[model samples]
Target: MSIPFGHQQLHNRYCFEGKLELVTALRISSGRASDETDAPFIRAFDGAPYIPGSSLRGAIRSEVERVLASMGKEVGLISCTLFEKDACAEKARKFLQKIETEKVKKDAGSNKQKNELTAEFAKLELCDVCKLLGSTVYASRLVIEDALPVDVAIARNHIRIRDGVGIDRDTGSAKDGAKFDYEVIDPINSSITFLFKMTAENVTDDSDRKLINLILGLLKHGLHVGGKRTGGLGKIKLKETDNAFYKVSGFENSTSLWKAIVNGEKIHNSIEWQEVIKC
Candidate 1:
């Protein structure tokens, strides 16, 4: 099948041509809002109540759009046929329409006029990618992508992928980490020109290809979190003093990449990072 339009072409000849990176740093604490049914109806739905996958996918795509925009390229909402005739899309359409209508009614102060609105029509439409990929890559703790350098390397058996890094939220210690939790990264199709922003520094390197590569290398390898747990409730500890340094690292790359693109130029990678000292 021919590649679709309004989407960045994946698997290109140049690293910077079709390849780019965007890192996102999530404010984990900000995610704890409850009683969101009182929030704007557009914001509340009956999905997992966890972070929405579409929100993350939208984030990645938005970053890609920003990078393309900087290059004087124009792209728009990547409308997908994946949702056109499918049951999920139809369901999503009906669901959104109902909620939007209800929102209007609620805003008009329509109280207690009970209509036969089923609970099924209020769920959020998750990103189809998550269903296709079979895990929550969209809502995972982190997502990082690197445009592969043009020269492809050949190796026997499976090539070793690099480890990404994470920092302890409590103590100011840096630890090697995976870009995502298990069942998340496994099904990603590298042939596609999309990757999750791993750490914040990757989005705007100061044209320091070497430094960027060095940092990516350090991150590409798995960083360890000192704990013995599995799944979403994993644990780690760092001294309080160093917390801010790592927090900065998380934002240096993803959404901030667009901020750097102000005045029609990409921001230089000039931020200084210092290792956090343990208390």
Candidate 2:
């Protein structure tokens, strides 16, 4: 099948390695518990506090959507409930249908055909967010790894309980039996790191890259994560330590991609890709 998107004809994948510092206590609650603390932070298999990739992805996507909306651009995939009423949603649905129809015709009982269909789907003409983060019709080009604490021992020391109470509107005071406690990651003593990867297939344009960079810029400005934002929780600052951008069309081996990242060469200055910070 032919590519239905714009000028781009090859895949361009970019990888970002970064660290997240908690400026304030972050409380990504795992929900209520029977223990002393009513809420607790989410933990990994090893019983250590961790930030899920999905959480980060959702946060970034939401912020980018807001930015796009401010520019009078509708990039987010809207819900079906609003499809008929929203112009953006209608456009997205039509685009998805076109890809789905073509994919069905090209679908054969072979891995090659499946891969080709996936590639074609990724190249569809859709909103920037849907193109990068994906929607129902396309697979996500962006992959975010779980952010693990750099030092587990140090991370443990940062965990603390914060007490809270609900207030009665009429009395303007704490409501009776409304006291609660939740666990939080204290920023005073800890920091975490994570990895980000983006695969831009058949990208002949710079709009998506510019948008991704804008999202990263927003992330650096302290994006709130988790819950209780009104109560001053989950404020974080993300810093990118290393990044690599590659044109993967003519590569002889896939292992070279990892090698480029490992080499740590500063290639963010290139015009072909967006400029990313090194520190």
What's model 1's lDDT at 194? 24
Q: After TM-score superposition, what is the CA distance of residue 36 in candidate 2 from its true location, in Å?
A: 3.1
Please list the C-alpha lDDT of all candidates, in the order they appear. 0.28, 0.60
Which portions of model 1 miss their true places by more than 4 Å? 1-104, 107-142, 146-151, 156-265, 277-279
Instruction: Tell me model 1's lDDT, rounded to 2 decimals.
Output: 0.28
- Determine which window of 10 residues in candidate 1 has minimal summed lDDT: 5-14
lDDT of candidate 2 over 53-153, digit per residue (tens)? 77878777777776665552343232122233644346656755765676688764365654555456445444666666766655666667777777776
- What TM-score, computed on C-alpha atoms, does each candidate reach? 0.21, 0.66
lDDT of 1 by residue, 1-279 (tens): 221211122211112112221122111112232342111111123211122334433444333333323431222112223435644456556655765687787774232322213211221243322221112211221233332222222111111222234556777577555242211111122321122233321221121222223323323321111111223221111112233212232224324545545645444443444332111
Cα RMSD of all models vs. native, in order, equals 21.4, 7.4
